[model samples]
Target: MSNGYGKKSNSPILASVLHGPRDLRLEIRSVSDPAPHELQIAIKRTGLCGSDVAYYKNFRNGDLQAVAPLSLGHESAGVVVAMGESVQGFHIGQRVALEVGVPCDDCRTCQRGRYNLCAKMRFRSSAKSVPHYQGCLQERINHPAKWCHKIPSHVSLDSAALLEPLSVAIHAVRRSFIEQGDTVVVYGAGTVGLLVAAMAKLSGATTVLISDVDSGRVEYALHNGFATKGYINTKTSPLTELSDKLMAAKETAVDVVDIACADQPDAEGADVTFDCTGKEICIQAGLYTTRPGGQLVMVGMGTPIQTLPVSAAHLREIDIIGIFRYANTYATGIKILSSGVLPCLDNMVTHRFQGLDAVPKAFEVAGRTVDHEGSLVLKVVIET
Candidate 1:
């Protein structure tokens, strides 16, 4: 499809806007012209994320609270329709995955190749910043051309939209410092968790295991070959008594994960563990499951303050790494997705919505505790 819509029209574009908690509105807003270094893209697909659900249900996620109306959505892919004078290396009709965060290139972090931590970052759909950096839930959006990565012709726009979360997984895997043939365990079977599992296998992990409170997700991971083995947290436990709870959690994981990995009754530790669920119990379970001197990568954004097994980590000398949003991962993520190695990658989209008008219902569906078939909602995509 030709991406160029030609010159801007005087009419406004229909957009999905969030006024506050559970207050979503369909409105028309003036289209923005691309800046000297930007491209105006017609957003074709957007994946509704957990953060979006948090914003929709609570009007806040973590420390970020919405004080003003903001457009909602970040995981998006689109076609470049217009470009500014300074834009280069791209032309009209290019399919691109929009990197939602635009970092200030001059920042020290950016200079050091860690632009994801740029203090002046303007992240889409984030209300933490003043003047509210809006998102791509609109018909047209002007984004920095540098942050837009072109996708392979074989990649569907829907799949391209998922590169954002895949980038997060790539970053998590990178931070774990996984060695070839290392055993890896990923906690949580959500989109990021599943991607982490898939990436771990692709990174040459000897055995990859996944655990989730949702049985369906664990089953999905195992059946889809995302993980070599999967564990379902059949029961919920309160987050207390670190030592006792850690032991119990580890034993529980051993009972399930061991059957899948070692085919033995006894439990063994993984060389690396990834906690994609921010739940306190999941974090403890991941830490407890990692072997001494191994590594733990925390990728989930959960409660700001969490209780951790500090003594265990210190005694075991397990390296603990925390990652915020991804940096320098879009290219690698897109390349991996385009490689067509992940046969089940496209199946991750368990639900889909039609247009901007479906945005609210999309979010509502995304916020559901149970999915359409009463299973976990792995991923939801909105085609605009």
Candidate 2:
């Protein structure tokens, strides 16, 4: 099997598999032919995200732990090599982006068009399921044809891999309940956060402010036109303890919010707020940043349980809405990326490493605030 074709091989192909905390092994794994209603793909690229990094570093993401060794990648794109007899509208050599989640069609959530909330969903590279589904860190794998989306010829396979995150941003923005000329504030300037800010502006928001702990990322959001202004919650004191750090983060969010909210001429606070960091601190601060009767969208995943300022939410009438993955947003992602509405969008993949052997290195780079050359690290891609 090659980067473009996943042919049946007599010998197993190289795969990046995670054994435990800080233990990622390059093993040889065999891939079977596509089952009925499936398509075998030659994975070209996989982009690592915060969840992937958490699994690699802690063997878990939030409360979910890996029960067995698994290949840890979900944001990926590939080429169709072989299609099952039952597969339709697909052919060999066609470019596609893998959605990576397979849901039970009969589930009520799925039937209601909220497949992402289906209890029986098997999301690749996630430990939420008992027997975890394998990810796309290998050379080739078979997936359900219904979950594989064809991409335009102009969309590079590398960028197609990012469609997963783009879908997430789209979902977040849609749930934000943004209105024309509204003041919107986004917390966290990561790839998804930046995308959310840009989409909010395009959705008719007059003021968009993005916040992050990293100064470089905040600046990137401003210079890239993702946000009208950026805010960095700088470190004021050396907080060595976890509790202290979290508290300091919370205070920073408050500071950022206080400053931005005071500038709002039309409302007491932002019309809508986004907690893209998923950190309890960000969530707590959003309660204060958002105006009365405004909405706060939770898009990121953090610790399973944390203390929140429920009093602030109740008194301010802030609607704290949570989003679990994305529901029915892949097509929107494809259209936005195909239209090229975002300039320097491809540059978001700041670091690209070659081969499955570099998978570990890619994760290491993804966790860093700055690259070896002092450049900001946004997204890291592994090319197989």
Candidate 3:
């Protein structure tokens, strides 16, 4: 029997699959038609997030192991090529960014509006459950219509691909409840770190400071204006020393500290601390850095089990909050990208690649590069 589209071919489309650690192979597979209430998209652009890299490098993330062959990308944007029956509000050639996770709506967590924690969530490229959901690295994808968010005409597909991570930052900002005139510190100049700083600024932060071990990223942040005070280079220095240096340089104690790096530091005196890095040290550092009664939001994904600074959190009355993917931030993220209110996008996209052939190269560049200025791409587009 012919496939859903009646398109017959000797060789199917190509996709990158993870067989094991550092084992990414391009394989061909038959394409399937979109199910009812789904849309088939011709993926145009994809971004190499840290999680994708981790899966590529280690073939495992936290408790997610690549027990079976799996596609390796989730941050993607595409154009609708076909729509299934009952799929409305989208058309052919419509550009879109997909929300990769689909939850069983009947679950208690899902019913509680915590869909990210739903026990039956099938996230693309995730191995937490069997019969893993494939990702959007291929030429065509069939995705649930509800999970797809249309992109504005002014916003490029590259920027749309960023919507996923941007939503993460937005959710983190919401969790922090950053008020107007708050002083914010982001501890990592990576994409998420940079995005957090930018979002915090948009959320009415009077001052936003970002720090990274890479001086290049610091310089990039300064040039891009993502941080009000530029990037803080925290190389080989203790947390206290770094905090002192930042305060001396910026002339104020950071009110909100967002830890975006994988390695955390003990940054004391911040009213709010966010651990976006998902590393044990960074988690501990977030707790240590938060002021009494402040909040620490954990956004990054770490090991299923890890040590934490319970004593510091309990003693200081720091509220530690966990963040799953995102709730309803796609439209907000698009607005932020389209309004041009956030000037960080210009500087954020430091690098660009053309065509699907360059995807592997893009991953290589993103993986090996340490300098944010030279390597940080606020958005990377893989064009046809």
TM-score of each: 0.94, 0.93, 0.85
Q: Which candidate order results from sorting by lDDT in descending order?
A: 2, 1, 3
Q: Write the per-residue lDDT of candidate 2 for residues 102-127, one digit (tens) a residue.
A: 99989788999999999999999999
Q: What is the C-alpha lDDT of each candidate?
A: 0.85, 0.85, 0.72
Write model 1 residue lDDT over 334-354, tens digit each, in one string.
878878887456798888999
Task: Report the poorest 10 consecutive residues by lDDT, candidate 2.
Answer: 1-10
Q: TM-score: which candidate is best? A: 1
Pairs with backbone N, CA or C atoms under 3 Å apart (clashes), candidate 1:
none
By lDDT, the best candidate is: 2
Model 3 Cα lDDT, one tens digit per residue, 133-179: 98877888888999999988988777788888899999889888788
- Give the Å shift of residue 80 in candidate 1: 1.1
Worst 10 residues of 1 by lDDT: 1-10
> Model 2 segments beyond 4 Å from truth?
1-11, 235-266
lDDT over C-alpha atoms for residue 127 of model 3: 83
Candidate 1 residue spans exceeding 4 A from truth: 1-6, 9-11, 237-248, 260-268
For candidate 2, the clash count comes to 0
Scored by lDDT, model 2 comes in at 0.85
